[model samples]
Target: MALQRKDQDILNAMSLVESTKGELQKLRDNGWDSLMNKVSSFCEKHNAEMLVMEDVFVDPRKPRRKTNITNLHHYKVNCFYTILDLQLQEFNDRFTEVNTDLLICMASLSPLDSFCEFDKEKLVKLVKFYPDDFSYGETLCFEQHLDIYIDNVRRDERFKNLKSLGDLSCLMVKTQKHLAHPLVYRLLKMVLTLPVATASVERCFSAMKLVKTTTRNRIGDQFLSDCLVCYIEKELLDSVTNEKVIERFQMLNERRVVL
Candidate 1:
């Protein structure tokens, strides 16, 4: 509760949320197979006979004939496995090849290994990923500058113990080489802003779900946007005093602030 709303603090909050969510998600990922097998065993205990199941979307329905009762468990098991299969398919559909490549490139930017990500090829791939964002000459220049930048900085005592991407960016800005390596700096800026914005946006959506549940779903867009801005930027909100609010409110009405 006392944490400042610094970028790293916000990131740490999001990371903690992610760590907990990930621990729970392992049950959904790796536990599914075993859990489904256990469900199959339960069906077997209920006299479900093994039958080859085909992948088809069929809702559970009452059997029309006596003979169909024998295959009831088959349908149930098929439905469960079919759902698991579809979930895996959906996961694949969401995390496409390009997204995976970009994530790998992001990992390479980590500074813990003494800024070891001086790889021209991986960074070239990163720049190439957003071809529209980089001019061809800038891309080539960045590709060349990467090696020079690391070699120029790595052996220096100041850069030896760096830990995170933010630390590296600060060092670069402190040294004022971000001007010299604009493209790389741009990429670093994107890397810094993207995840933080993504986390904040995701949290805002979750807050919106709470605020605008089905019963309250008619919230006006302007009100909703205003709520989100305040909610997402609560640290700033905390710093604002009630007198200031009253002052602003009175100014709107041309009266003394009552607070």
Candidate 2:
């Protein structure tokens, strides 16, 4: 019966935990109780009726006593969760509802490293999901479709006399005058706009590491937070309202002597 098979699957998954009891016990001994609890909770909540063992491999390296390193063994357990067909459909529909033009623009502006790794098939899928929104009118929807857009543009007498980026910009400016939906116009503006890179966040962390080196590792968490906030948000620090400054000074003065 289907019910029996589902029950068997759950049992098989639980058996994997039982087989790893020794490792799990070691983890508990090492103060990983919270992690163990989370894994147990995930299994309980997911209704993972079937668990299948994947690949298992053992390291050929000899154990090192000084480093407390032992032979490594890796194993994986696969589990499945059931979802209703309607739920899946609803999820797919929501993503499909996003405007194609906006999606393409966002995708174009996404980190180069992230977008470069996507395959042609994935790109096609994305385009298909939001076909109506993209400005494939100016350029081909896909590299393969480039000729289509080019032919369309070439045949249009309005664009026949236009050439170069300046001409394209002028056309775009003229077209904006007739936009019916303000939301679409705003979305287009956002997609065309370049996003500022967050290299400063990385720089801030590097500065924090330099400031809190081995010698200062014992620094209190609160003090370290205050120091970093002041250093990183120096501009905002200068703009602190007079009322806040007065309240802070009053609190500090009350804690000690008035100067």
Per residue, candidate 2 scores C-alpha lDDT tens digits across 1-259 of 3212322222233344344444444443453445445665788899754222232332347433233222121211111112223344443453333442334334431222322322344344444444555555512436454234334434545654543323433454575521422322333354443222224556678779977889999999899988898787877889898788778888875556543
Model 1 — TM-score against the truth?
A: 0.56
TM-score of each: 0.56, 0.25
Steric clashes per prediction:
0, 5
Which pairs in model 1 have colliding backbones?
Answer: none
Best by TM-score: 1
For each candidate in the order shown, give its overall lDDT on alpha carbons: 0.67, 0.44
